[model samples]
Target: MRITWWGHATTTIEANGTRLLTDPVLTSRIAHLRRRRGPAPLPEAGECDAVLISHMHADHLHLTSLPLVAPDAALVVPRGAAKLIHADSGPAFSDRCIEVAPGNQVRIGSLDITTVTANHDGRRLPWSGHSGPAVGYRVEGAPSVWFAGDTDLYDELAAEAGPVDLALVPVGGWGPSLGPGHLDAVRAAEAVRRVRAKIAVPVHFGTFWPIGMDWVKPELFLPPGDKFKAAVDPEVRVELLEPGESIEVLA
Candidate 1:
């Protein structure tokens, strides 16, 4: 399988001649957040077979970004998310939206994808009506891969995902200090150990940040990947990719 990190939680996964995109925040800026590192996402990201939305958070489920995807690419969102997106974006995704909850499965070409639970709040807005089960994906093919959308460490982690060739785990957030329901370098390493993945990739870091705060502590953006590499078990190999960078995970 080939994986490309498109900055922040956006990633492209290609396997078995099919392409799957995850949490696509393709534009350079969303609301007040700006892409501080890496180039804007390329047009090729729009040409995928499916798009996986991990949750309802704006960064992950941007209504504006959804239209950029190929008209044929199915939008796999959390259960009940279609209503919110439909209400908020209106007619943006009337045709190709699939709502999935934890343990639900969907097939696209040769890959079989199963939704797994994530330990994060998936609220579309700060006030109310959160989406169901902020989830991750287990993409099964020749070389299976797990794209952990956004999560903190949870007890059922190991059993939920089983085994996979590659794991994409989030290690940081856009802000300087990560709050509850997030995994920093240390906890993400523990997640690596739990999932038993041969190769792990650190994501959700070194991408976007609030305006004006970029220079306050700039080094905070890029170090989570390296920190995760250092803290994970020595047996597990860590592959860190910058935005727009791709790596092949062998079976």
Candidate 2:
């Protein structure tokens, strides 16, 4: 299996001749923030086979970047997302969208994808009037991969995800202050231990940040991945890849 980190929560997992992209944010930057380090170049959406949206957050389920995926490509989004995607912007929005709830599974090419529950706010904002449940995904192929989306530690996570060869976890966010429904470095490391994946990749950090906050500690933007690696058990190999870098793991 080959995993490529595009940036933030975005990643492309290739296995069995299929490419699955998770939470794509193709823009060079988002809101007032910019990608300061990692991945001089970002991958285009057309390069993927299917797109998985973990939630309705602007960064995760970006409407502007949705067009990058091929029109024929299947779009797996959180349950009730179709109502939100179509009602707000007419039927033109997400024409290929497929709604999925936890435990729901879909077969695309050689991959079998199963949606898993996520513990995060899944609202489309009042202006959009589109709301849905947040979710994670367990993609099974030659080597199974789990994308945890944006979620805090939950007791049922391991059972829900089953056994995955690679686990992609969120360790930080855009800001230093982490609210509920998010995971810090320590918590993420603990999650890695619980899931017991053969390989772990830390994401959701060192991407976007609020403008004019340069005075704040810069390390806050860049240290979560390393911290999680240090805290997690050494037996579980951690691959800290720069954005846009790809790593191949044999099953």
Candidate 3:
């Protein structure tokens, strides 16, 4: 399977001749924050057979980037998301949105995707005018991959996700300190160990940040991913990709 990190929580996974996009936040600027790094590859949502909405957070479920995918692509979103997507972004999303909850499965062409529970608040910021459930995905095909969308360490995660070839785990956020229901590099490394994935990719770091706060402590934005990789068990290989970079893994 081929995996590409597109900054923040967004990723593109290709397996079984099908492309799956996860939490696509392709815009250069989202609300008050401007992407400090170069934008992700042009036309960010490219030829995806399905798109996974991990949660309703703007950084994860940016509606602006949704249209980049093919209109026919199936959208695998959390339960109660359809209404919220329509209410927040309008009815244009109704055509292909498929609402799913933990343990639910959806098939897109040759791939079978199963939703998994996430230990995080799923509600979209009421002020943002969007809301939806939070969840993760376990995709099975030529190469099974687990995308643990923005979640903290939870006891049931190892048993729920099972073994997979690759795991995409979030290690940081766009803030100086992580709050309840979020994972720091140490916690994310522990989560990777629990899942027992053959290969792990650290994401959700080194992306957008609040303007004018760069002086407070810039290391917070750049080092968490590498720190996580260094702390994790060496048995599992780790790949840290810059935005727009791709990695191929054989399980």
RMSD of each: 1.3, 1.8, 1.5
Candidate 3: misplaced stretches above 4 Å?
128-132
* Cα shift from native, residue 22, model 3 (Å): 0.4
Off by over 4 Å in 2: 39-45, 87-93
Worst 10 residues of 3 by lDDT: 38-47
Separate clash counts for every candidate: 0, 0, 0
Residue-by-residue lDDT tens digits, candidate 1, 91-136: 6584578999989999987789999999998777676575577999
| Candidate number achieving the greatest lDDT relative to the actual structure | 1
**TM-score for each of the candidates:** 0.96, 0.93, 0.95
- Residue pairs clashing in model 3 are none
Candidate 2, residue 66: the lDDT equals: 70
Each model's lDDT: 0.87, 0.83, 0.84
Across 107-191, the per-residue lDDT of candidate 2 in tens digits comes to: 8778999999888888875467677889999998667888999999888988998677788999998865888988888998888
lDDT of 3 by residue, 36-151 (tens): 77576568455688899998877887888877877778888988777777876677776579999998999987788999989988988857555556899999865688899989
> Model 3 reaches what TM-score against the true structure?
0.95
Ranking by lDDT: 1, 3, 2
Candidate closer to the true structure by lDDT (higher is better), 2 or 3: 3
Clashing pairs in 1: none
